[model samples]
Target: MKIIVDRFISDSESTISHISVDQRFVCFGLEDEFRAIKVLKETRIPAGTYKVALRTRGKHHQQYIERFKDIQHEGMLEVLEVPGFTDILIHCGNTHTDTEGCLLVGTSAHTDPENMSVSSSSIAYRKLYPLVVGAAKNGSLSITLEDNDR
Candidate 1:
């Protein structure tokens, strides 16, 4: 499966993106700000294609299992070989604050009263997880992150 993230919004606090699979719209994504000088948990992953897989065991996997007990999945989706980054998983969250240099999936993007960007995270994640798992059944999944700002 080939997933594409088109990052159209680049701001000081976060980047909002639209995600698609094989030309089909899937979800919105929220990531931390893009900075010339990268800061831990405050910088978005570089735009590039990365191999993705479902990890059955790891800190993220365990955490997801704990958080979403009703979701019948064995592992979390992991973006592999991200240069200078580790443990980058495409998981659930609403805002940039919820991510630590990882991708957050959401159904829709909105600006809150506090002026922070957020999304309908859990619903989108639940919708995404199964599609990814189904795709992985055929073969390895890959994602291409494109910076539209450029």
Candidate 2:
């Protein structure tokens, strides 16, 4: 399955996760886990195909490699050559700037951009958590910046 995570909606972003399961590709919304019913978000990577790669930062490095290995081992999704090297993968961030060079997903259990006591309540988790969880469960998600009414 060639899963495409398109972000072409208004006021939010979207993410598509492909999990390796018994030599098969399972593309779904990461947000589905939380029973989220909405899709799409602000700031998208435009309409184009890009190669997916793993960009690990810290301790999760091992987990990131495992994910890529699983994908290749199962023959589910193959990495492609994207112009300008726009690599996308699971990373940590709370806002648009957090994305930096890659797709910024939910925040980590330890690091919350805000100093607030409630980490989960942070903007990152509150907005991205539900969306990603839903995507993972649904097997495909698109994020857009355009209003539905428009």
Candidate 3:
């Protein structure tokens, strides 16, 4: 699986981006503000490529199992080997407040930099988790984060 995140909006508190898989549009993405100097959980991961893996153990994984019981929930779709980052999973959420340097997926996105957010997050995640997990299990899965200035 080739996941691509195109970050287009950046603000003091959040960043808004679009996520695609193998050249196909998938969902909207939200993450903490991108910073040159890291500020613990308030900074987004740098623009680079990272492999994806199935993280079976973690707080996210445990909660996801119950939250996504109706879907084929296996493990958290984790982006591995992110420089200076760990447990970077592609999961569901509404805004930067819902994440800590991790990517959140949603069906709809708002580009207001001051209050960037995504909606229908769980709906989007249910559709996304399986595809990512399947690819990770089958073979190599990777992602590229690119910054597109607006």
**Which prediction has the highest TM-score against the true structure?**
3
In terms of TM-score, how similar is model 1 to the real structure?
A: 0.87
Q: Judged by lDDT against the true structure, how good is candidate 3?
A: 0.86
lDDT of 3 at 77: 85
The per-candidate count of clashes, in order, stands at 0, 38, 0
Q: Per-prediction RMSD in angstroms?
A: 2.3, 11.8, 1.2
Sort by lDDT, best first: what order? 3, 1, 2
Ranking by TM-score: 3, 1, 2
Q: Which ten-residue region of model 2 has the weakest summed lDDT?
A: 26-35
lDDT of 1 at 113: 28
lDDT of 2: 0.32
lDDT of each: 0.81, 0.32, 0.86
Candidate 2's residue-wise lDDT over 1-150, tens digit each? 133332212222323332222233322222111112422332334335443332334444554446435332212121234333333343444444444334443323221222211122233323433334334434443332111211
Candidate 3: pairs in clash: none
Candidate 3 at residue 98, lDDT?
87
Work out the TM-score per prediction. Answer: 0.87, 0.33, 0.95
Question: Candidate 1, after superposition: displacement of residue 98 in Å?
Answer: 0.7
TM-score preference between candidates 2 and 3, better one: 3
Off by over 4 Å in 1: 66-71, 111-116, 137-139
lDDT of 1 by residue, 11-52 (tens): 667888889987788899888878777788878989999988
